[model samples]
Target: MPRKRYAEDLSVEELRLLLIEKQRARRQKRLEHFRRSGRLVVVDDHPTQPPLETLASRPLSEETPPATANPKHTRLDRLLLAIEILAVLGLAFVLLNGFTLIRDLNREVVAMINQPTLTPTPAITAIVLPGGHTPPNSPGGPRPNDAEIPEHLRPVMLSLPELPTPTPSVEQAIRIQIPAIKVDAPVVQGDGWEQLKKGVGQRLGTPNPGQRGNIVLSAHNDIFGEIFRDLDKLKPGDQVILYSNQRAYVYIVQQTQIVEPTRVEVMAPTQEPIVTLISCYPYMVDNQRIVVTARLQE
Candidate 1:
């Protein structure tokens, strides 16, 4: 046998030539076997080698060892992934809170819309027609005309407590001037007993001056300045001037009537703008009512 040559002792050029010759021999042997078996042979440019030996023999730059992850880089990637997950979870929480807030607001608005509205109803001020009074220049001071009230209702009317008068407003009837009757007097808010004692008292539920409803005003014919003493003298076409804070409203007298005290229908609301003046009829005798109806001048 020839002397054995170690791989380490061989020159670089000689080793390269030896590796090429070995590869050529292996390819020729494989080709001969395939030819004998009548099979097609595919040759590889780089022949297979032991995996560990191939990797050890290659230069460090060429090997690339599957690019094992760096410890610092792996930890940084894990941290970034955790931060992204937290960001998604935080966005979801904010969206859920916003949705809950909107749903609550909608419920509150619906509840408010479905709530019932309350309308103010005027209080009942008197039991019977207003302006009832005792005869003028009587022995006792002017008292409620119990004779005018029905016998069965007198006790109830007498027992009724006085109500507080409402504060005067600019829209209410403040004064009245009747040219035919030569009457000029201040107008107050309520037609209750105490209210009529001051001056002319407007019925509680009547409309204000010049409005499209009955404006009922009352005063004692025999007492309380006897403001409506000459109401009967007023004739149709006569002017009844009513004043508010803003301006004066002239109402033309339509008619006058003497009705039983129980005829409260005269004070009922009217479709047109009208004013109703009321007082006890027949001067000193206070059993019936004298109503003067007037329409607002156009």
Candidate 2:
């Protein structure tokens, strides 16, 4: 048998003649098939045959139906789309974490400033002289019993003179002077973001000047004036002078450390009067905190 040719390969005249012959042959075959099966076929009395010119007049539409997409390519495209969505979500999560970290750091600073101060009642001190004269709370009076004196009170009674803790009605921190680090900024009674914007903030609930407890003063290292920018330069024996209550309370730097922000122990109370200065670590990137601890000079 000869190889069959498609409509695209046939001329207009040939295609037209071929279709007419094929239609007649199809009718004859249908008639013979129905007779063999003994089935009566109903034929139209006036069969309206379509015009043969239509075959050559209008070429078969070249616009074929679209082919189905490949399953492998479709699956690969879907996987790529899923990966892109996941990447976008991951980027959003990281940005959210960064924002949260900055916000929480600011909130922590503000909370430290707004915290209420807990005032301790003045301790009663009754001392007896050599002549059995009981003086009313005289710090200068000679203490008799060395064994009876509390460890905290021993230094004040024997060597260092008693320095009274300042009791200001309102929270007021005048000035902070760290000559070693070249820091001489006005002090404010807050560690809040807004307060720190003005100057260094003194944390509430800490000891006052000359008091026998930890005095925490914290400020920003990179932003909001960067008051404690050179705080890391401070070392042992460096003097940190805080002028308040018309008196200068000098503190000798004992040690400096870089600690996590969650380390609240750095701000805990102490038996002896001390000063703790805190700032964000690593210069511009504030991921950790730098703490400088100092004790009051006698």
Candidate 3:
């Protein structure tokens, strides 16, 4: 028997030719099987031509096995795929909205922390009290009764410069009439001693006549026409008519009290339209102050 040739003994050219022959044989076998299964069809114009030879003449790309038919996608499969896509999109949208909300809240908190704080300043402060006077017809004449002022605050009163007197206007209190006390007096701008000498003095910084807040009017009980001599006699509901250049505003007396000279709170501002009348107490011995509070008549 003849011995078979080993692959190791073959030349390079011969090995290459051997691989080509084996590939052709495998392709031919696959093409024949496909033809029998009706996956491949051949038509020849010349009846005498061999089908194998014709197939071998075609390109290698054409000799590939027929592809299997793709599986059909059902409605349920399509629906599931669409649902997966929508769920992904919805999750993305929620994440975006959550991030946006968090960012806005952070901005608001930062703004609140950076905002400025406001402090309220009181409209009235503790200074010298009003309605101080000497004895009626004293030998040296009438003067400020400085003995009543607290010793600690005496320097402040002496050092305090007189505020500029406001110009007379129609909006300011020009006259005051209290029929219950049989008193009618002229009203001036300031409550200083010189201003009080002219007539009843309206305290500076108080509200105007008929307007909101406290309207402080002061006068001496024994001197300067003794404008508020009988202020204590006014009863509740007694009318106190205050006149301006434009018109007159009537206020009803509410109450009266005798307070210490340092009890300056009686001159403080009020929320509603009101008036506070201040005068020295008693007939001639002027020491404590008598305060009469009245509310504007509706």
Query: Candidates' lDDT values, in order?
Result: 0.82, 0.70, 0.84
For model 1, the stretches where C-alpha displacement exceeds 4 angstroms are 1-127, 154-167
Q: How do the residues 136-187 of candidate 1 rate in per-residue lDDT, one tens digit apiece?
A: 6677967877777778877876787765555667888899999877889998
Counted clashes in each candidate structure: 0, 0, 0
Best by TM-score: 3
* lDDT accuracy of residue 117 in candidate 2: 83
Model 3 ranges with Cα > 4 A deviation:
1-126, 137-139, 159-161
Off by over 4 Å in 2: 1-172
lDDT of 3 by residue, 1-298 (tens): 9889999989876675666578778977997898799997767534463455465555556667778755565667888999999999999999999999999999999999998875445543446468787886777877887778679987776776656777768898989999998888899888878989988999888889889999999988888788899998989999999999999999999999988888887887778999999998877988788999999999
> Among all windows of ten consecutive residues in candidate 3, which has the lowest summed lDDT?
44-53
- All candidates: TM-score: 0.54, 0.43, 0.60
Candidate number of the best lDDT: 3
Poorest lDDT segment (10 consecutive residues) of candidate 2: 126-135
lDDT of 2 by residue, 1-298 (tens): 9998988999977876787668668977987798679895557745676566654464544324568899999999999999999999999999999999999999999999899987665332211101111121336532222443346755554553333444564334588999987888887675645566678777656667888888888877665566787888988999999887568888999999987654656776678999899887667455567889999999
lDDT, model 3, position 141: 75
Q: Give the TM-score of candidate 3.
A: 0.60
Candidate 1 pairs with clashing backbones: none
